[model samples]
Target: MMNDEVIKLIENRRSIRSFEERPLDPEVLDKLKRLTLRCPTGGRFSVIEIVDQSKKDKLCALCENQVMISRAPGVWLFLSDMERFYSWMKEKKCAENFGESLNKPGIGTFHLGMQDAIIAAQNAVIAAEAMGMHSCFVGDIIENYEEIQAMFNLPKYAVPACLLIFGYAKSIPTSPLTSRPEPEYVFMKDGYKHQSVDECEKMYEKNTVSFRERGVLPFDNTGSYIEWYYRKKYTSDWMAEMSRSVGVFLDRWLSDEA
Candidate 1:
């Protein structure tokens, strides 16, 4: 059985859009810092920044122009980093080029940094909820990733994972908690066997009715999910341009060193 504190937190963790005027208690803020520090790092350390209303509004505008996010009062940005390791290694750091340094962390450092950053972000959110606060995870912060790098003045090695918003709760839906596919279906006992695209669509189709009831626009199938996602996220020229440019920049950056 889940622990009492964990169960209560899980039940209370609601994704809130609106908020009360109160800022979080300083004691609660301290707790989040401690909890996040214990989050699994995939063996690599990361830096996290908690954002305020002014910065959050600016970031929301810059990232996606989404007014909803611009209105949130508390937010945390999880960033993946490799430069910090290089700093610790001091001048002794070898593999001067990015691509060449892939082996430095034993071939999995990059993934570890990402995984660690995300887990830490989740910890902050869950802990915030346990203290009677509400939160939401905003993935839009990276939609314009290059802009994100520039906006934060990020140097060579940090990538933002997500934005975790916090505040006192206002209203939340009374809808049934969303269901997952059978545990057996989602949990693999051994090696992975990939499913076909058509078969994948079948599984998605079964979830569309529930999604609609939850105010999710109709996604009758995976293709429909694709259509809606593309329309909302990919159609923006600025978003696409930034995405392509960032990929090119990172590739060139990686190409420059070992």
Candidate 2:
């Protein structure tokens, strides 16, 4: 079901942050856009490419000052859009109840939209990598919900799902492939399998050690890498801010008045 070229592309793809200071070839960019559109969608979603320097700069700030936003040739924002569908329904004089259902979507609708957006994003990244280009997914696009919505002039049912910045890498990445847990640890047989606290710790220990060795997490004499990681990442200010933003966005996006 898989070929060597496709397998190699998947294996070698990595998140590239440092990009060369240049624009992508117009033809190549156009081809990439076409390839991305071929990705599966649940009948709603849109991809917007941002090339304006002023807008990119504002986006960089909104995304917690990730300099890669400013360095990349262009950024693609994937939106979970129901506005177009709503407009069509209005023009066709759809039933009031049917229109109201779409006007006030629930959590399941959000999940479907987010899944579609992310799937399209992965397709875009893989296509870019195949063409000798690099890309990184910016989940932080959802951090400043209100500001981002206003900046993009998004409609009520349209929400920013994710961002992918694409460009040529300045140099090859030197980092080794990151390790993952064993298949048994993550992949359950037929149904869900809940692990105990100790089991969870064991599964994560390898990654914790690797992070410390790579100097990503400062090593203290205590040698509790997991503890350090939880404090540094899970409990960080940015994580809290992102959580708050998600809640606020959900409230507004799913509101009947939205």
Q: State every prediction's TM-score relative to the real structure.
A: 0.76, 0.91
lDDT of every predicted structure (CA atoms): 0.65, 0.82
Which is the leading candidate under TM-score?
A: 2
State which candidate has the highest lDDT.
2
The digit string of per-residue lDDT tens for model 2 on 32-108 reads 98888788878678877888898999999999899899888969999887677767877776756465443445567
- Please list the residue runs of candidate 2 whose C-alpha ends up more than 4 Å from where it truly belongs after superposition: 96-103, 215-225
For model 2, where is the 10-residue window of minimal lDDT? 97-106
Scored by lDDT, model 1 comes in at 0.65
lDDT of 1 by residue, 93-124 (tens): 55553435534333255556678788888887
* Candidate 2 backbone collisions, by pair: none
RMSD of each: 4.7, 2.4
